[model samples]
Target: MMIVCAGLSAVVAGGAGAQHVAVSVQVSSDRQFVPLQSYVQGEVDGKLLFFCGLSDMGLHVFGQGAFPAKNFSRQIVMVDRATGAVTTGTTDHLPLATRQAMTVTAPTAVQYGSILYMYGGYGPDLENPGDYFTRALCTAIDLVQVKNALQASQPVPASAFTHTECVAGKVAGAGIVKLGDRFALICGADADGEYGSAPDPEYTNVVQIFDRNVSYVNPVETLDDGQGFFSPMHRRDVNVLPVRMPVDRAGFVVVCGAFESGIFLYENPLIWGEGDAVPYEDNEFIQHIGGYEGPIASLYSASHDRNHLLIFSGLSGYEYIDNEFVWNPAAPWTRQIVNLHVDGGVFARELVLGEMPWPLTNAKLVLENTLPKTTDGQVLVDQLPFGQPILLGRIYGGIAAEKQGSVSPTYASDAVLDVYVTVTPEGPVEVRPSAFSRVRGLHVSGGLSDLLQSDDLRLVTRPDVFRTSAVPPVQIQVVGTSPLQNPSEIKFTVESRASANNISQRVRLFNYDTQKWEQVDARTMPLSDTTIVVTISTDPARFIDDATGEMKALLQYNALAFTIAPIWQAGQDLTMWTIVP
Candidate 1:
């Protein structure tokens, strides 16, 4: 008989002084209870169909003898949410390779309508005596038949699953997102050797696109910005969710993942839209919490043009202690639940809402409740009724750690948590007036001079007028106001006009922490007036000066022959700074 765990209540605050959204988790059992993690789960008619994953606590040990076949989750589990009835099925009818592929750990799985599409995972090869490898196979499971068989407590028919072999299926621990009719297999590894030994695993630093039938389309390699830096796409075991992009477009956001080099996790997020060739790495924002695979949910506020993403407790690189964000290089498991708000696909703000009841990791299944949602599965937050507790979704199955560290005793979590959100009534949105600040000093040709304090289009750095051998970047200093305390709260709008569309400018911000000038924005200026808004949302006070409260910026020019208009006021000039309340 299956045992159903009671509801565990956890109320997390939204934002600073925002209403408290009560979130809770209630464990439900449909049949005989079996603990599992890193499994593929899909919901059909209020029933959950769970496919291959790991049944052991924590992960496989790193040694010569790893990934024992006994630890593989071989049984198919089903849970009825309405009645709490649990059922199980077997994989004996599947072929050896298909069975091995179905039982492996951390395979990419995404449910599209009634079909559950599952891809490669790391496990033992049944064909070989003492070998384990990442399976190169994709399986399409019929959830309707699987649910029916499980509900009847009968064997699942072999026809319920269709297997295909392709090069795109050779990925494990990767994030999979459906872009319209195509599926993108994001960064992951294709490992064959034993854990922590011998040949290093190859990181697939490319997005493998697949059609609706899991056939290969093309691979989008990581962008080469000529910096020769390690691409952030070399990630695995991360969380990726379908997000509503600007103009209600479909996209996905790749959250933090592990092993940048020797177990250091990536702290930044990579965002990709539907039609983009590659995803954009948001270097300006550093995600401190929810850095690994866990329960994630998203809601879109069409009225406000913002997307709110709720990330539950998981592994993280930083933790808040004594009101200070402390960096943990070890990347330990955390109970921190973060709410990331993205406005117009440009700016992102992270708020630490609350924590989970305990430090849990690897619980990656979130079955959304029957709420009004868009076609891409984003909850329409604007249409929901206000001031009441709303059922968001249910989180099921992960590894529960005893402590928040790299080394800790763990167990397979049996908690089926019911996630709830209480939407509070918001006032009418206010459009804040753009605040402009004048440039005080200018540095050109290694000489410090005061720029003319005027609200006119003064030619400050014209290559054609000032016949110079090299175009020196004009450095400007602007004192920040008290309202501009953090980077996310401030927006820098630089307006400029060039003689030709080929003329480009690079904007760099001086980082006081690094003592180096970092390029923030670089774009080609058109013949008409152009405005570029740069927003930094990662660290609160990285670029600001502590003692003098001053910020420095540089404008580098590149063109055949062009002139840059100087700082203008009253929305008519080169530089303008605004703060969002």
Candidate 2:
């Protein structure tokens, strides 16, 4: 399948049938593989066979509920990027500890030259803590042997891998990136056990470079901790994508992740470089980009200097309320297929709405377009102006949540997507959201009716009309004084002219995950002239079970509003206001 997105001018000049750079996605009908096992994956010889991950085949999210020992999978899953084919086999033959080190939930992992190196992740305790009980264990997968065995159709032996047990430096969830030879692992903590609240001594915002030749990681510098505000220095669950400079040099762009040090936890994509202890420039490029944010995947187009980040669906952080920071660990997972133009080490985000699947967090994208014959083939970076539809890569095995909380039980996604990027002459494409129009009747309604009065729904208030007959409950859609990327509780209060018994109010909320409107239950105030307030929110408790990140976009796109009316009596009227506090 091919989807085209081109500039209007280019298309008009080229006439109909003109093509431009476009992207499309297709899920194979017959390829439903049970991917209960989740793992950090990398392309080996351009194939996805190098990995260390496990998913509980049962019905639970990673850190939630009891850890199921029986279904823990330690396997090398190879996904053919060209055809969207996934193949897996148990790597359980390796030492149990090595497998566990690689199987920890949301570990900082990367792959290089037939070796999958994983560091710092949350999991069961190991005796070899950096001498302490920790999940900061590190392990390496020797894909050279695994690949040979697979080519021969022979079972892999346990001796084919290497394990580096815990140390004070052994950390989980640290953000890491590789320049040439050195792997700079950044900000993470030493945890005692699984899903515990906090870490003992937070791993200082230090840069630990693990050179390929060195046996141990060497600490270089520590970053200044941010006090009164948020900083990326002391953060975990962060991801970095590769970028190329206009010159010969290239580096990684650190995407935003979850940070708990502040009163509120959220992500703001920041770019920094190893060349300088300072970042490219302190900037947060806001785009339509979506992701599970932390446990995410990225593909860089060296030719285009563009990084395609696959932000699968996952939880979001909190919004600052009156004085408190309200967080939603299970912010609905919305599908985000975004990219960034990297130049001079700076990032410019491009929020593109494309033909994509639901966001898959904790998922891995493997490039399969490289030469297939050689074991060490050249890496193929996606280039625009496909001239025709071309397969870009494949996404396999990640968790898709059905609930708001990451701790809640979630089933593994069973399908894999094949991304086809095409460049046509259609010109640069822009999509405008459809105009909203609707008005409510007597009972209850949602959609455009809840929005504020417009030219379509003109509000001509006749104060004199209340002198005789009855007044109707008013529904209003609100656009605020300022725009909000992450919003907290939005409140709607009605000052009723009648007795408290005559007050009634309702709201229509859009649930992106379910693609439905949820009704907010209304209630009356205690006073005679009641002031009834109902809050519309993204709080997991207030939203539908599986709603996702798209809700924020829907609300921001001039679609947030609610209704207020008199339910018990006919001769009553009310005044209303909306507040996002």
Candidate 3:
């Protein structure tokens, strides 16, 4: 879901003595390589390796040689999580040609245990700067050895690269996810080279699958036929993100990404195994992230019941000026970090965590320590015997540009992003029960002390600005067990010193067919000099209209929202709703 609710922020009081479950970010000075993206990255034992990409943080001048040559006998950048140390290493034993192909940009890499397996990308032809060669090689780095070598201040161990295989046509830019023995290559493609216009490389409209057992067993340094795949997926790109659900194991979502070399935002997320892909108009979330022509990275939360995807620096918001798209070739990438929080079942919410100091995108989010998981891959919360924060790991470089439309020789990066996660005990769930009905998961603004203060109880509108076309209500959701949705009346008690007429209120039910809100009438009566009871009833003649199926769609909802804009402070609103059985 793009987003069910726009936002939800509260000044709630909790016994934990903290304000809100928040996200924090910090950055270290680069002092090494410049900003870089679309390169191969992997993490092991708290050490991160920034392998192969446009070596310089500027326009990739054609004849600048592969990263292996540039890094030859030189130390490769490595970030240590435990000590927050940024260092470099050298794989001096690898052959010159081998190193050159390995440093190719736009390659695909995935980390499992101590092994970092990488695939195809565009590398040097050794002749023209613009003309390039599509690399047809796969290399595996033994991360444990590299980490140990970095510790000893030694060149990358001779045994660092335990295996290398050559597999043609398995190009770069594919969204890869390892599922058991099979790894899927979600909609990504490659070309012969960006050699002129007519002979430009074509994209593949297929989701390719490769068997790990078959892929890794090839003779070291020998080329293989490498025939293992499942085809015919809609062409996708760097935007595909992994999300595991009970129904779909090892599932992934392809958000806003380029297809057919064109910038278009799909409406709904494209699932890995969904028959055919169809997206809607998404202007808020993914559409805002430029053409997605740049790099993007994602990491999921390990806390149970918390599903959040952190997307860092992928060219934010395609500029639209006066109803026209303002396309700029030199637009710099974003420094903003967006957090997508999934709550209330399929309902999802969006929040902006914070921003990085500089433009950063297309990087790595490596897990430093082991995360508890069930046999089914669900987050293993009960498995934990104690309560403590998990120091999951850190984020590494992407492309960091100096300015918009920056010239070449300055377009990459060498920096570290520090991250930490804290979790608390689950609090008691609040349930609203009345003589007629019961509502579960009703999150109110107050704690025990605030709820006890009668003076703080009143009816007022929500403080935050809710989107104009939202249905049901922002915080009030109704899950009625009974099929009788057409309640004869809904009663709510409120306290107000002003005239009852001055307390303007409207009740809107979600219309299923029109996808809009329809307002209904409510009658009011005085409860006391400063209190009142408002009753809203359904038209029985409307139920008769429900028989025609036309009005049935509109009257078939179990819950409705009441937007009450009282003169009093809305943050103090005290609301208790009841349905006439």
Candidate 4:
């Protein structure tokens, strides 16, 4: 039986009878002599093998495109990229007739010319962790054609590899990618329940790299073993384990959800199982740039930089909820919450409080295609090794008594309290909030319903607090009138309102020490119709101006307000206000 292989072609219709056909000849075949492994598109020696289908006989060339090549019981004809033609190849090229009876499970394959590489997956003797048979994989190279058959096809003797224990069943999971001068097969998880039974700390931590011209792959010898790349964890039941080859990174490979612990990367070849696997102990491993509430579901590397990874929502195992964060390998992954003033989108159109932007793509081109490109706010400008001090705009909305007591006005009094503000972005991009300006007064809405009214100037009021800081639950100094004639009680409160035309308003208090805004407490009266009165017994010398001999109040109350409105397009019509007296 003669094996037929041909490259695919394309025809372009031009003026009149003039036609152009783009033809690229493939002197090789995708058919291989081994069971299929995972399939991927890659360049071998600068040649693009468009459609690569896997079979135990040999990696066959079905065409030079993404052509469906499953079900061997049917005819085995591959298309040619050069002539836009299809021709029959070898009759024994595939074992599709009896593929269902094959004992191997999770069979996958990838080909570069005649060289077909098959790796990891369960086959035949399926057993539990204890009784499971661990078989490795078989690697075959150079199944070139013996003769150039027709002008349209090439002929090669049929070849197939026998399954071996090295790559047989021990191959639990694998993904393939061609890099530089070799093919890298990332082997992971447990196939036969070995790790599930007694539990091995190094099961999913292993990776194998195969060089060009090698027929067999030795997991221990092929590539770098992940040393400092993994976080150690006790073995347990695992299901729905999924891995992906993110495109942002040029040459790096990352695997996630081994036992639902965390994501691991091969920053350098042979990185797994080498140095300390414990993230806390191993300083060489890529430090987590930030902490995410849940395990990562997807990670996208920057198109230009490999050091940055964009993480998307995934389960934290606790809530099965999705959280996002940007992970920089150079720094320890720390979790941060950034309050953003949002208008509309998949995420709610309000200020995202106690939340941060999830890093998932290359920072270089994140907002390149947005309506208008933003340079400063949309991108990360600086990095604080220990997180440098930043100015967070604050709006004082309310206040609370730390401990109930007859409050007195004195710098040494334990009742001395601090203030803070939480500044959230009004849009998706980055923003730097300015300090509260007395010139920029606060504008309070009559009520929640007042916010729904458009062009209703009467519904807007200017009685809100105004303040500034660069921290969450921001902090401020509470100053009031001094030398009180009679003791009275004062109450402070913050209320927020949102509507469709002009909705998405929020308020939160601040903490002086932590330098951030405390969650807003709205029950306190924002502006009580009645003033809080306090008794004063201090010496007149302390309150009276030395030159004027008149008592004056040193402390003052602060207020702030914010409003957002949508006028057809997104991120338009917004107002911010702050007041202090």
Count clashing residue pairs per candidate: 11, 35, 24, 110
List lDDT for all candidates, in order.
0.65, 0.45, 0.44, 0.25
Q: Write the per-residue lDDT of candidate 3 for residues 1-581, one digit (tens) a residue.
A: 11112111111212331111334556644323345556677777667676766554443333233233342123456766556667776544566655655656677766666788877776654445455666666677777887787778876755676435455335666666655555555555565654343253455555555666666523212111222122223343456655554444454555545442243433234444322232122234333332343433333334333344555555544433344334444333555555554331131644455555665555665554566643222233333322234544455666665643224224456566655444322331111211111111123233322221247453222323322233312222221111123435444333322222322333334344455655553323232333434555654223212222112111111112333443111222232333342
lDDT of 3: 0.44
For 355-443, candidate 2 gives per-residue lDDT tens digits of 24554555655444432211112123333322345555556656665544334455667677666655433332211111232122222
Model 3 residue 249 CA deviation (Å) reads 2.2
Give me the displacement of residue 226 in model 1, in angstroms: 9.8
Q: Distance (Å) between predicted and true CA of 514, model 2?
A: 49
Candidate 1 lDDT, 460-564, residue by residue in tens: 333323322254333233233222234344455566555434556677776878988888898766666566878866773666665543455566555534434
lDDT of candidate model 1 versus the reference = 0.65
Q: What 10-residue stretch in candidate 1 is worst by lDDT?
A: 443-452
Question: For every model shown, what is its TM-score relative to the native structure?
Answer: 0.67, 0.57, 0.55, 0.29
Least accurate stretch of 10 residues (summed lDDT) in model 2? Answer: 552-561
